[model samples]
Target: MNNTEFQAARNRPGVERQSFKKRLSDAKFLLILFAPAMVFYILFEYLPMFGLVIAFKDYNAFKGVWASEWVGFKYFSYFFQNPDFLVLLKNTLLLGFYSILFGFPAPILLALLMNELRSIFFKRFVQTVSYLPHFISNVIMVSMIIMFLSPTSGMINQIVQWFGGDPIYFLSKPEYFRTIYVTSGIWQGVGWGTIIYLAALSSIDPHLYEAAEIDGAGRWKKMWHITLPGIVPVMFILLILNVGSLMSTSFEKVYLLYNPLVYSTADIFSTYTYRVGLLQGNFSYSTAIGMFNGITSFLLLYAANFAAKKIKQVSLW
Candidate 1:
């Protein structure tokens, strides 16, 4: 009866599924375009995932991955029970939270402000200038930050001295790490991030603005009532994605910027994992730490997506 009904549906117009070979032929151009990324993901992403099992093993370099002893969750238990666990957790969360609090809004506010600009030339200039920092090498960017905040000959300290205040080393103090990290992140990413919001803004119908004008709405009112609402779905999507990475701060920037003097506020899971795995040769221990961070990040992402879908009807799905 099911086969007869399926044959009946297939016989009807537009009810038949394409055969595999036909679908493959139809999608050949798209497959060609996607081939490089597919190969790269298979090589670097899917292949490396096999090593995640090392997190559960007493991995040995000479004995190899499969021959290694199975240690179960000992490394994970050790990490959770470690005295510095809370501090590491706190530092990672605070940095990610601060970044979301400050950095997330910077792009939206910038895009809105730029949207209101009357002169195309000036707006383009501001955008070009804002985007330049993102292209700067991390090493160069950190070096520039160090120079600008230098206590003795730095531009910031120079301003402080002009006000008759003492010069303090910003980089050496633990108190300043989160602020500097978040602020620099905003500076580097704000312009680039705005591209999406700007595109969202552009998609908002011009007819809506015209209708608002005819209804006695001013520029501010139209922007408040129309423009902001237009990009809200995009905002929620980005926010949810940001929440997903709360436990995994970028290792390169943090490692470059931090020293032993600022470890209290600067130490995070990625850096700790790097030190344990690469520097100390504790492969299994560090892999466990990384796997733990990955799990927490996944949970955070899922929770955020769930909440966003419930509250705003907007999510990655």
Candidate 2:
């Protein structure tokens, strides 16, 4: 029956609601469609959370997870009191803050500019060139950055020397590390990031722009009045996702780019955890650090969602 007929049948004096089995049979196709994603998350995400017990245990490979001796919060307290705690926290927060400050708006601006482009050929070419960098592996990306900024034969240093300036080792200096990392990240991902905003832009009703034009509005006015409002929800959702990861810096890129010389500014929680946990085999200590990072990220996500809901009435929820 159609929805109206179904409702009419339900409203009849002796009619009864459908059984759970009937509902399940009716939704079987959708259930089948959702099965793969449910299975994937169960296997790779939720199932692995059981390993978190190691954060409170003195984990031993020989004893396995459950058999490991209970250490309570020993590792967590040790990390809090460690000499590198403050520095690592500072570096991680600064990198994340700077990335959001600069990196977040980059794709929005690019999407807006691309939307305004009159020539499809030129726009496609620009997008193609921009997206190429994102597909480059992290190892290759870091290697390129190192080579391009090398003091001896690097392109940037060579240009500086040609202008009668000294060759500076960019990656070796602590002060320059964050800038290089954040800027390179923006360049690498901005184009790929624009794809979502562009999709959002396309979904905006074209009639809004037409109506604005009919009222003697120009390109900028249409964008300001219609285009931006249409995409504000998408932007806020992405912002919330970014804030959730504020404490989780890219381990692969940072590990590849940083050395002892730049560790003062480049060492973050993820890299520190890797060294202590995997390299040094201090499993319990590493697990504690990871747990702390995860907890902080969860709190940030909650706070951001709360603030966004209050301020803009837009949130992940």
Candidate 3:
């Protein structure tokens, strides 16, 4: 049969579809390329899910996960009743919310400013300088923050002394913890975050800008009309992802930067989990807390995605 006749025959109800084996053989090369990622997720991500059962168990190390006695919702109830529960939840939510409020827009603003730079050399230099902080290890970054904010010997204190003002121990002050954490986080991640928006901006049609220029639109007008809209989809996707992880504050950075003095303001779910699970060996309770955190994140993700889809017609899915 000719091409059209063969296509018509294939589209008929009685025609059999291609077998799975046939399709797999046809795309074998592509599947081979994808195999490593699939294996990695299965091994590292999905397999660990089996251990989540420990959250419901007494979780004796000697008895092992499967052999441990199930305690149902005992740990969850214990956590709910704990006096520190509200404090931990409040701190975690406030820190996450502040980080999102400040850190989210910082990179976008930086990218927009970078895009407007007339000198290519200066733009590249600024980008490189900004991105360098992202590569700094959490330990090193926190240490630097401590050194800078030290009341007696720190640069900040030195500057204060030069101005004949009192030196403030910034890290030890509970009121300053959120601001310092959020600002440092922005410094570390802003340049890396700009990468996505910059990519989106690059893909905008050059003709749109040309047309805007011809219509007597200035730089700000063109940016407001063309540049911002061009990146809205990318912005929405990142925002949803950010909102989904709203409860997941950086444990490493917080642990390194905070002390007993700042625990009231700085203690979060992850840090608390670490202290309970590893330090104190209350594995069951820690696992329960971790499970609660995971569930909260999942719900946040779902809600954010749903809202994005309904309001903006944009979503990760």
Model 2, range 31-147, lDDT digits (tens) per residue?
Answer: 999999999999998998888899999898999998989989999999999999999999999999999999999999999999999999999998889888999999999999999
Q: How many residue pairs of model 1 clash at the backbone?
A: 0
State which candidate has the highest TM-score: 1
Model 2: residue 310 alpha-carbon error in angstroms? 1.4
User: Relative to the true structure, how large is the alpha-carbon lDDT of every model?
Assistant: 0.93, 0.93, 0.93
For model 1, the superposed segments whose C-alpha errors exceed 4 Å read 1-7, 11-20
Better of 1 and 2 by lDDT: 2
Tens digit of per-residue lDDT, candidate 3, span 190-303: 999988788899999999999999999999999999999999999989999999998999999999988999999999999999999999999999999999999999999999
Residue 141 CA error for candidate 2 (Å)? 0.9
Candidate 1 per-residue lDDT, tens place, 53-152, comes to: 9999999999999999999999999999998889999999999999999999999999999999999999999989988888998898899999999999
TM-scores, each model vs. reference: 0.94, 0.91, 0.93
The list of candidate 3 runs beyond 4 A from truth reads 1-27
TM-score for candidate 1, residues paired by index = 0.94
Model 2 steric clash pairs: none
lDDT score for candidate 1 against the true structure: 0.93
